[model samples]
Target: MNTRPAGQDYIATLDLLRLAAALAVVLFHYFFRGAAAEGFLAECYPLAAPFALYGYLGVNLFFLISGFVIAWSAESRSWDQFAIARFVRLYPGFLFCMTITFAIVVLAGSPLLSASFSQYAANLSMFAPAFGQPFMDGVYWSIVLELVFYGWVTLALFTGLFQKRKLELIFVWLTISALNEFFLGSGAARLLFITEFGPFFAAGVLVHHIHAHGRSLPALLLLAAAFLISCGTLSVTRHWMQNHYGIAVSSANLVVANVVMHAALIGAVLLRHRVRPSALILALGGLTYPLYLLHQNIGYLAINAATPVVGKWFAAVGCVALMLFVSWAIWRSCERPAQRLLRIWLGRAVDIGLARFRRVSTEAQPAE
Candidate 1:
């Protein structure tokens, strides 16, 4: 059912789902990955590690949601508008959170976590690794992937391909993704086309197509293809976990988790009518971006600092609560205002540029 709430273009349920995915990632980092033999944590939570190990899948969930959301967002705007909207949405929050993380790491950084002026400067571009600098926070790697995805979407919109030949485009994209991931194993292709994670993103786009335009045979088939490809790509994550922690996540569990995540996306779209949109729901969704951006390294520092006095469980829980509050504050106090200002400035600049280009074209044309 494509019944969105009146006067709203977005599905409110998706916001809640985003927050849930963010929390899962936070827990995964805190309870499982942080405690590995060479992990960041000073203490381990053996009990929670088993369940939290699966939490890394939350990033996969975020990609799926982003595909649906980006497609929905691009549908109603011109290419420049889409670009501005995405920039204003992502950059302000990223800057604020990145700066906060930088300051924290500089002032109170442990050997495990620290920052330099060059690194911070590189991070300002939002693609730090290209400049031979590491991300100030490890979580920024995902943000870079997101930026690459947005770059592709912006290009598609510019060429009118996204609007006119979206399904065909997705087919080619999925095909390339399968080839590189399953056979070629080219790291460049993996980075450029996002081969490893493209299926999750493509699945999201197909889901949006079904939600908005109604499910057709072709769309359904492509979506099924996406699901199968996604299951295969889970091997990438399994391999990483094995190499890093020497733990193997079974293929069966990975497939089951992937299935459940895809199912959840479908269910959210179908039952969207049941979620009533409210300011609180919007805020929860808003906070998730900053929460995801700020949670990892800063959280490690916080947990390590607090664990001795308050104990490990309280330290972990308290750090989460603190991060949530900080993220909410950033969303409300920083991101909203900065976005409003950037939207105004960027909108006017784009309008002026487009007007000049039109004038030049008009003057260059012969009188009819």
Candidate 2:
């Protein structure tokens, strides 16, 4: 029947999938990485470590989903509109979560975690690393990558290339990603082009293109290439884990995990129609952002504090539940209302700036 949904249609399955990815990341931090060389946790879960070691791949899954969602979001939006949407979508939750994390770190007075006012102020810009201040939570490095991706998208939209030459752009991006990753190995290129993670994002965009438009041969081929490159790029993560955690994921295991994630994404889109959309599904999706932002450092502290009273496993479970609930509350009370207000204000400001620019251009036109 070829019942693929349009760009405007909400995919309830994706919402559920996003929540699952976020939970995977939470588990990774709590069960594996925390107890690894970092020693963020006092108690260790040796039984769960092997499985949770792979959970870090959830961030890769997130970039893939983001590529799809961002491509879909940009379909009919102007550059300014897209910018506003991205800002509204990200900044509110980020601001709320960052503030909450900062408050908790200060209150906890934990020797392991601390935040200063300058750090908080710099984090407000969401690029605290540039200002010689650390991110309050370590997970924010991924958020910065996301912002860079958004910046590139916004630039593409402004140039009209996003609509007219999206595939070409993806091709160029993938080539650069491969070159930098395999041959050049330039740190600057890696950061600027997101070479390490670009394939996941590119694969995601191709998935959306195939679903929305059709299975054109170029799209399919590019997708295959993206998948292959994405597998190769996991070595970067492997090396990172080795350096930090003293363990490395086997290449075969990485490939298998990558395949499963990509397949799951494809299946979610294909089966989205079978999953009914509801407020619950939407709310589950909404909490992922705040949960990701809030889970790492604060959660370490929560588990640390509660473990003494409730024991390790109980503290871990309780922390996850508390994080989920707080994330939901923030989504409902803070992100939703703030997004509405920010969208309206940012939209109006953009309109005013655009109108004034148009008037100035018109006045500058040559007359007969």
Candidate 3:
């Protein structure tokens, strides 16, 4: 059996890092109930506050990794091929999870669920809650953003914008981000999908380019600066209309910071080879999607069930543990198997298309 230990190289190392990030998110929720201002849930946990605070960063880490990994996947393929691959990779898991979540909500008789069949249909299609209303799955928002990024990448590829000049692309996005930071408030600065994140995504693309170009002193310095800025460790303050603009820069700044840190972390993992303890990390990655989807609802249920029996801390812990266990089981069973099935189905469709094309070509030819 060619079970092939999955992550054996730099790419694998990034996968391991992704798993670690997922675990950080899990631990963050487990301890702090997803609230940053709150301290540890219990006296036994000292690291909870820092960990929970960084949980939001974990999602950005996934986005940064997604951009880098998608660039890596799309490198050798044409736009159409890349789009199909991305669709197959993302949609199947997403749809399945959404359905399961909606069903669970319905079964649980949550008042938040749609009252009618059409409303349920809308939720299932992922287009519901279009006007600031949260969707059936709280985690679906990020999925939507990811889909937008995928569409943007596809458009860039078709327009020849992604053909060459990787760093130039990154710089262009950075400029947009900076300029947007300067002009528009943080709210409007977020319109950078067309204007900004391209660079961050391009930075991921630049990761491939940097390897080809070879690292230089200047490049290293720039990367270091970008890293510092993204991590919010760089102490630079500029005025933004009475606000000190310390933590509250442009939305573009926060986005850029996230992408930069993400790229740096992925790059570092790829560059280094040493493996640390990863059981929890691996488990977290496997369960992240489900946990993210189910955590809030499950946590609520858990609190309701346990608040009467024990204190909030004990109840929260038990709930989180139960959620984790259920998510892990789903990942092992439904999620992994469903993904495999979808891949197979998509592969067969591609094969059929190719076979039909060949047949049409053969019939059209004259006697040869």
| Winner by TM-score | 2
- Least accurate 10 contiguous residues by lDDT in model 2: 1-10
RMSD of each: 2.4, 2.8, 6.5
Give me the runs in candidate 2 sitting further than 4 Å from their true place. Answer: 1-7
Candidate 2 C-alpha lDDT tens digits along 168-229 = 99999999999999999999999899999999999988999999899999999999999999
Clashing pairs in 2: none
lDDT, ranked from best to worst = 2, 1, 3
lDDT of 2 at 215: 97
lDDT-superior candidate, 1 or 2 = 2
TM-score winner between candidates 1 and 2: 2
Give lDDT tens digits, candidate 1, residues 183-250.
99999999999999999999999999998899899999999999999999999989988987899679
Worst 10 residues of 3 by lDDT: 1-10
TM-score of each: 0.96, 0.97, 0.70
lDDT, residue 363, model 3: 96
For residue 151, what is the lDDT in candidate 1? 93
* Backbone clash count, each prediction separately: 0, 0, 1
In the range 144-244, model 3's lDDT, one tens digit per residue, is 66667777667767777766644555565565655554455364444435333333444455554555457766445445444433443211221231153
